[model samples]
Target: MTEIELNNEYFEWMCQLVCNERYSRRLSYQKLLRHLHNIDFQYMLPMDGNRAEDGIDLRYRFGYEKEYEGSTIASYLDNSPCSVLEMLIALAFRCEEHIMTDPDIGNRMGQWFWNMIVSLGLGSMSDSRFDAAYTDDVISRFMNRKYKRNGEGGLFTVERCKYDMRTVEIWWQMNWYLDSIL
Candidate 1:
């Protein structure tokens, strides 16, 4: 099959997977093979440099590496009449709650999420000249501090708050702000 055809088949499979109701035993290798067989497509299992082990992981790997640079899943989803904001929120929840809890993986996930927001042209308000309007606020909330000047014109620092704060609280605040706008 041509690359485009493979991509379309993959996309359809992803949509089905996302919309599937059954979570338990839904993502097994057999299930994937069955789905592909039903679609008349044969899976060419990856040998090396695949980066991930499963269909979902492969899709995410493609997205993160910008293999689909000009054309993105977010843009496709945005064309729908339904709110794409929910999708973004779901992504945020996964990143912040599930992925970001790990000290090793948290920052990478956060950076990836931020990059996606920036790429979709959803980073800032329509009338604003800034790349993102609420980025500083979000960062401040995440760090649990007020923004302070560092004696530099554009450089600023966060002064840590006295009260102890949890990372989850900060994530929630960021998610809240994102939900309000998008």
Candidate 2:
């Protein structure tokens, strides 16, 4: 029996979270993940400090709850490239799946994830039309907080936001997004 590589396992897990039997777009997600991984290596050091915390949170999640390779996210990081954008996407998936559990809502897999991608103006980025330069531009805009005050280019867009999203952390932005949608 061939053993599955941990990085492959993790990527498959991430892919599964957003692409399931009910809603599957495995190839597109893989492309996006690859894109994020490649770009993340360059910006691993947080532009600000908040994303570092988000990366830590994601590391802990993979280490403790999931027990990927006996609770050591460092190994994963060393073995595979993961970015704050990827972590944020994973967190959003977890929130949509676990925290906001409302069966009545019929939340399909990748629903929230795609919502965020679209909100970031990255919905058009697909395997067929994948543009590395454009993707990098969008990611740079997000990391540099070039998004509008209302979060237009960021993960969440709250038109009537109480906080300036450009200056807010992603966690708060996600919260406001979840709040706004409801």
Number of backbone collisions per candidate: 0, 0
What value does the lDDT take at residue 71 in candidate 2?
34
RMSD of each: 17.1, 4.1
Candidate 1 at 30: error in angstroms? 14
Off by over 4 Å in 2: 1-4, 21-27, 41-68, 71-73, 76-82, 97-99, 106-109
lDDT tens readout by residue for model 2, 1-182: 11336556655666666666554454465676677755662232244345544544554555565665543456554444447455555556566666676789776537777777888888777777788888888888887778889999877888889889887566667778888887
Candidate 1 error regions (>4 Å) = 1-23, 26-66, 71-77, 82-89, 92-100, 103-182
Deviation in Å, model 1, residue 137 alpha carbon: 37
Computed on alpha carbons, the lDDT of every model, listed in order, comes to: 0.33, 0.65
The true-versus-predicted C-alpha distance at residue 27 of model 2, in Å, is 6.7
TM-score for each predicted model, relative to the true structure: 0.22, 0.74
**Which has the greatest TM-score?**
2
Best by lDDT: 2
